[model samples]
Target: MDRQKYTIALLGGTGAEGSGIALRLARAGHRVIIGSRDADKAARACSELAGLAPGAALSHDANPEAAAAAQIVIMTVPHAGQQKTVQEVREQLAGKILVDATVPLVPPKVARVQLPEGGSAVAAVQRLLGDAVRVVSAFQNVSAHHLRDLAHVPDCDVLVCGDDPEARETVVGLAADMGLRAWHAGAIANSAATEALTSLLIAMNMRYKVPGGTGIRITGLEETAEARRT
Candidate 1:
């Protein structure tokens, strides 16, 4: 199957995770718009990313404008700012796919699993944006450091979860474009597991003192038809 290109807006794109994903998507021939609370910050990020991936389509705007211009919107802000960022673009996000990569990791004890009252960050986004927007949760386990260094293909699998199967598949395709295997991990409710896994990976990174990013890979099902379909 041919890869489907998209105009993706990365909210909080000035940050490491958002900018890294934007660079990868742009390098894969997608038009990427870096969005941030400050337009100047977004522009600076776009400029820096363009240097890394020359000739890749890249642009920048405020969060609302970027969200309105893109086919898909990804929120990569820290857990504390997720709600505010999503709320700013909620109106522009109707009838679009909003990829929530925000993991609820309360700082001081980030390594410890500490999910919000709603179970996961994705669920909270769903409640805020309602059904009009397809909120797919993913990219929680991958590391920003690894994503920024595009020289090496990541040794990780993205666990995508969403209420809509088609939405999940679309995100899986995006992951594939970044050279990572992605799987449909059931409904949006299942996002809790992946979100919690980020904390575990953080703990492991500290425990083992792994300089590079430590990630997870699903084994024993590589040959499955379903896996290939993704």
Candidate 2:
């Protein structure tokens, strides 16, 4: 699996989700490129990322450069940075699959689900990028803490929603590579439901004693010849 044809580019890779994914891919023997707004930050993070997977082709580059170098781009930045980030790297993202993991978490009252005026972050990205980029929404339900520890495969499913079937499939494959179970959650608008579920899960976590805990189990499937052998 490490011999995957292309590298995973993580924009805003210094952030929790982005960095966690970078490590996850590295552990899985896949090439990963961490993109940062600051060149110096990328340089520092790249060194640590390389340490995670010895001799792994892991490196850091500026957002645009990383986008250009990778086949798939996962945007792990916050909702606040989505538009500007896309605009800045729009040229590099052309014809690329851009996974949007943004959640509209209005900090002070994030306990409640808040859909933005743009409907959903996935829709917002589609609107902002037009046809230049293929945006897929995913990874909104998992905690960054769990993703970083490659030893623990969280019992969560990644809800991948996007207009482009190829892009969605690419993300699903990438999710599997990262030890995640990804589901095609329909068109980008469906992201509104999945993104909202994040808060519901968080509220449940708060009520319970489970810290940074949330998971989904796909029932009705037993270990068989056709299923993925764990």
Model 1, range 30-102, lDDT digits (tens) per residue? 9999998787788888889999999999999989999999999998999999998888998999999999999
Q: What value does the lDDT take at residue 212 in candidate 2?
A: 64
Number of backbone collisions per candidate:
0, 0
TM-score of each: 0.97, 0.90
Estimate the overall C-alpha local distance difference test score of candidate 2.
0.81
Candidate 1, superposed: residue stretches over 4 Å from native: none
After TM-score superposition, the amount by which residue 112's alpha carbon in candidate 1 deviates from its true location, in angstroms, is: 0.8
Residue pairs clashing in model 2 are none
What digit string (tens of lDDT, one per residue) describes model 2 on residues 1-230? 34355687999888878888888777777778999889888877778777766787788888888889988888888877888888888999888888988888888777799888867877988988888788889998888888877677877888789998888877777788788877677999899988888888888888886786876655654464323632
lDDT, candidate 1, at 31: 97
